[model samples]
Target: MEFLELPKRTSGNRTYGLTSIIDLGTPTEDLKNILNDYHHIIDTAKIGFGSACVTPNLKKKIDLYKEYHIKPYCGGTLFEKCYYQKKIPEYLTSLRDLGIECIEISNGTLNIPMQERLNIISQIKKDFHVIAEVGSKDSNQEMPISEWKDEMKLLLEAGCDYVITEGRDSGTAGIYEKDGNIRSNLISELIKDIDSKKIIFEAPTPKHQMYFIKEIGANVNLGNVKLTDVLVLEAQRRGLRSETFYLEDRECKLPL
Candidate 1:
C-alpha cells in the first residue's frame, strides 16, 4: 500500500528498494547511532569490502544491525577471500551464522572465470538474497559494454536478485567518468540492454545520484553509498528538496 504513490518503488523488507549504505571501518557505536537517527531511511548495510573481517566488534554488533531491520551483508571482497581460500561454504556459513542473509558476489578485485562466477551465483542464491557485480575495481579494467551486457544476462539467468553495474565507490568505472558523472550514451546503451529494475548502479556522489535519477527515474538501485550520505540520498529519492525537484519535472511530474 505504501508503494501506491510509486508502484515502481517497493517499500522496506523488499529485495529491491531504497539506498544501500556501506560501513567502511566504522565503529559499532557509530553504526548504532545511524540506526537510531535514520532507521527508517536506511536499508542494507555492507560491512564494507571485507573490512568487516578486520573489525573487532563486527560480530557483536551484527545483531544490533539486524535488530533495526536493516539487512547486513558481507562485501564481495570478503567473499573473494573465502573463494580463494577454498572455503566458500564456511564463508557463507559464517555470514549466515552472524545473522546476515544478503550477499554480493563480485570479481572486482580478483579474476574469476565466467563458469566459476556462475557457480558462485548459483550456490549463493540458494540462501542469501544475492546481488552480483559485473566489473573490475581497477580503473584501467574496462569491461566492454557489450561484454557487460552479456555478463548481466548470465547473472540474471543464474538467479541473482540484483545486478550491480560495477560503478566502484568513486563512480569512475563503467558508465561513470572520472569526475563522478555518468556517460550519457553509455548509460543509454546499458539501460537498453539490462532491465533497470533488477540492476543497482553504484552512485557514491550526489552528482552521480542526480544524473542517475534524471536519466533513469527514481527507482534506480544505487549502491556503495557512504554511511553519512544516507539521508541525503533519501531526500533526493523523494524529491523533498531542490536538488531533486527538477527530477520530478524530468519525469514529467508536476511540482509537489
Candidate 2:
C-alpha cells in the first residue's frame, strides 16, 4: 500500500521537533498499548503535576516508557512542591531511584527567585537532562516579553536542555488568553530572539496544537499534549488533517 505524499517531518530520536505527551494518569497497561503504536512519534512523556508520586506501578510505567525510547519524567509542579518543602535532595533521589533520566525544573506556581532557579538548573544539569520552564501559571501574573526572553536566555545558559513556555494543561494561562487564544505578540517576540528549536510550547488542545504546527512549522516542540492526541498531533504535523492539509515541507501550498 502506497502512502500519499505530504509534508515531511523530523524523525528518529528528535531534539528540535519534539512531541511531549502529558500523562495525567493513564494506566500502565493502557500506556503500554498506546506506546506500542505511537511510541515512534512520542519523544517524551511528562507525568503531569504531582501524579508521579501517587501513580500506581510508577516504576514499571517509567521503565516501560524507557523501553519504548520515550524519556519519562515528572512534571515541574512536583519539583516546585519539593522545593517549597525544602526537600530538593529527596526529590532528586526519588527520581534516580525510579530510573528517570530527565527532570523539569520550573517556578510556574512558586516564587523561586530567578538567580535561585538558575543556580538549581546549573547544579542539576550535571545529573540529569534538565528542562526548565518559564512563565507563571496564574493568568493574572502576566510577564513582559523582555523578562520572558531574559529568563529563557539565562535558563539555556545555565544548562537547560529546553525551556518550556507555560500554557498549563488547560491552555488558559501563561502563553494563552483566558478563552484559550494564543498571545501572538508574545510568540513573535519570543522567536525573534530565542531559538525556536530550544523552546517547548505547551499546546494541550487541538486548536492550540494546530496553531503551533501551522505557525512554527511541523517541527515545533509541543508539550502537555494528552496521550490520546499523539497520533492526531502527528497527523497535523504531517499535514494529513484538514487544519494542516496545505502544508508542504513546512510552507503553505494553498490552491491558486
Candidate 3:
C-alpha cells in the first residue's frame, strides 16, 4: 500500500502542531550549534529535567533559542517540586524573567489534587501557553484510562494548548509496559473519544516512537524527545526513513 497523506502543520512561529526537543542538559554552546543547524526543523526546545535551575547561563541560553525562533518551556518536574515546596509563584516569575513564554504544568512527581491541577492549568495559561501532562512519573502508579480521558477533555477545555500523556522520559512507565512498548489496549482506551492532534505522547525511546508510528501513524504528537534525535524523529514522522522503507518496497510486489 502507498503511504497515507498526512496534513502538514504550519512551521516556525506556530502556535500548535509543534514538534519539541527536550534538551536534557546539552552543553550551552552545543545547544546553540544544534539550533543554528536545525532551527527550521525544531518547533520547540525544552531545557530538560529542571537542569535549568543550575545551568548558570540560562538567560543567555534562552536568548539564543529565542533568536532561532524556538519557544522554550520549563521541565514539569522542576515546576512541581518547587510548587510542592511552596515556590510555584516564584518559579513562574523566574521563568518569565528568563524569557520563557511556554510552561509545562504537570503533577508527575508531586501529588496535586484535581481542583488544584486544573487551577494551575488555568493560571499558567493566563500568562503563558500551557502544556499539561496527564500521567504520573512512578511506573507503579497507574491512573485508570477513564481518568486520563477525563483529564484530556478537561485540560483542553480548561484552555491548555496541549495535553501531554505522561509517558515519562524513559517511556517505560505509565501506559508503556516494562519493555518500552505501548500497550495497545490501554492506548486505544485513552484515545477512544480524544483528539490525537492535541496530544503530545512522551515517547522518549525510539522503540516507543516506532510503535506509535506503526500503530497510530505519523500524525501522533510526541514529546520529551532528545535534541540529537530531532532530525531522525522528523524523518520518521515524514516517512523518509526505512521504518517506512518496507512499505515503499512493497509496491514492487503488487499486481499492476
Choose the strongest candidate by lDDT: 2
Candidate 2 residue pairs that clash: none
Candidate 2 residues lying further than 4 Å off, grouped into runs, are 1-3, 250-256
1-256: candidate 1 lDDT, tens digit per residue? 3542431345666554557877787788877887899877777787878787788878877787789988788888888888888998888788878878888898888898989989877766878888888887777766677888898999899998888877777788766766656767766887897878788888888888877776777667788889888788777776765766755534722122
- Roughly what TM-score does model 1 have, to 2 decimal places? 0.89
Better of 1 and 3 by lDDT: 1
Candidates in descending TM-score order: 2, 1, 3
Provide the global lDDT of candidate 3 against the true structure.
0.76
Error of 2 at 183 (Å): 0.3
- The candidate with the higher lDDT, 2 or 3, is 2
Model 1 Cα displacement at 23 (Å)?
0.5
TM-score to native of every candidate shown: 0.89, 0.96, 0.88
RMSD per model, one decimal: 3.7, 2.8, 4.9
Query: What value of lDDT does candidate 2 attain over all alpha carbons?
Result: 0.91
Model 1 CA deviation exceeding 4 Å by range: 1-10, 249-256
Candidate 2 lDDT by residue in tens digits, 1-256: 1477776667888887899999999998988999999999999999999998889999999999999999999999999999999999999999999999899999999989999988887788889999999999999889999999999999998899999999999999999988888999999899889989999999999899999888878888999999999999989988889988887773832111
Identify the leading candidate in terms of TM-score: 2
lDDT at residue 136 of model 2 (Cα atoms): 91
Any residue pairs clashing in model 1, and if so which?
none
- CA-lDDT, candidates in order: 0.77, 0.91, 0.76
Model 2 poorest ten-residue lDDT run:
247-256
